[model samples]
Target: MKKLLILVFLTLPMIAFAQTKPYLSIADAERITAAAEAKAKAEGWNVVIAILDDGGHLISLKRMDGVQIGSIDVAQAKAKSAVYFKRSTKIFEDVMKGEGGSRIATLPNAVGVEGGLPIFKDGIIVGSIGISGVTSAQDGIIAEAGVKGY
Candidate 1:
């Protein structure tokens, strides 16, 4: 029993350390935003991009000139939904189009829109990015570019 207790105590810290998740850094967030911005600029689209950490905390936000002011909140909501739900916002948008999908609207902070994607590192979600201001499909394209940057 003494040996077993010592082993358990010795391994506890390793277990805790192994469970620590990777997080999005400020530099990574900035890189993602820059990539998304480049895509938007190349396509001549004015948009708002929002990046969130694994905990759904805002890391970065960019609203291009001529983008609607309302898109700021929408972009953040999309990013938050992606991080909190661990999936693309497009899934919710698609579900909302189906019958009985109105229930999705009841979920707090859920945005039924495209352009939100969970950023992955080594198959684990590290963060998310959301874009707004252009068409949903276009926003999705920009978001994809941002995630690819990371």
Candidate 2:
């Protein structure tokens, strides 16, 4: 019995650490994209939406008809920026308006845009969403709607 107890204690930490961390599944990415797309359509905005997993990996991308081709890369960059910075891309945008903020432009993969948002589940970041093609503020609004859906 004492040996069994010792063995249990030895394995306890492994069991605790094995708990699954929240992750953004493909379905979740699709749902987020759908929500953002709906918002863009309702606003009559042609846009591109990008979703990235917590590790800043692309999960999904959707481009509405008539949106500029450039927005596709822009959307992905914004999502990556959100994941890399662990915050909204809008924060970088705001910082860019301040003195010394130009340095933000030098940060690799850091997009100082207003349309990237981090998606959180149970207070843990699961992924991020980014939108492009419309005005920065409008893209932000759409992104917000998407996060709300999640």
Candidate 3:
């Protein structure tokens, strides 16, 4: 019984530690944003960026010069939708649009809109990226630049 208690105490910390998840720090987000923003600025596209955790929670977000105000919420929603859905939001829109797309778009937490992409690291999905303020295609390109860090 004493040995069992000792083993439990020794192993508890390890178990607890494993339960803690690794998330991208703010600095990491800034680096991604800066890199992506620079690329977008080169093309003269104002963009709003969003980063979300694996659990689809917003971690950090930014809007560059001249981006629209509404782009902020839409960008975050697109990112969260991507993280939770685990695929490009564009895919859902493409799959569900027309015949069933509109219906699927109505699903809860389904932002089948656009400008959402999963952030992968070492083959695991660590988070998601969303961009807005420009065309959805342009937003995609900007987001792609940020994902290079992964």
Per-model TM-score versus the true fold: 0.86, 0.87, 0.83
Against the reference, the lDDT scores of all candidates come to: 0.93, 0.93, 0.82
Error of 1 at 149 (Å): 0.7
Residue-level lDDT of model 3, residues 13-98, one tens digit each, is 99988845456667777777887788788999998999887888878888887888999998998888888878888887687766
Candidate 3: lDDT over CA atoms? 0.82
What root-mean-square deviation over C-alphas does model 3 reach? 3.0
- Candidate 2 residue pairs that clash: none
In terms of TM-score, which candidate is stronger, 1 or 3?
A: 1
- Using TM-score as the measure, the top candidate is 2
In model 1, residue pairs whose N, Cα or C atoms come closer than 3 Å (at least 3 residues apart or on different chains), thus clashing, are: none
For all the candidates, what are their Cα RMSDs to the real structure? 4.2, 3.3, 3.0
* Sort order, TM-score high to low: 2, 1, 3
Off by over 4 Å in 2: 1-19
Off by over 4 Å in 3: 1-11, 18-22
User: Taking the tens digit of each residue's C-alpha lDDT, what string does model 2 give over 115-144?
Assistant: 999998988998999999999999999999
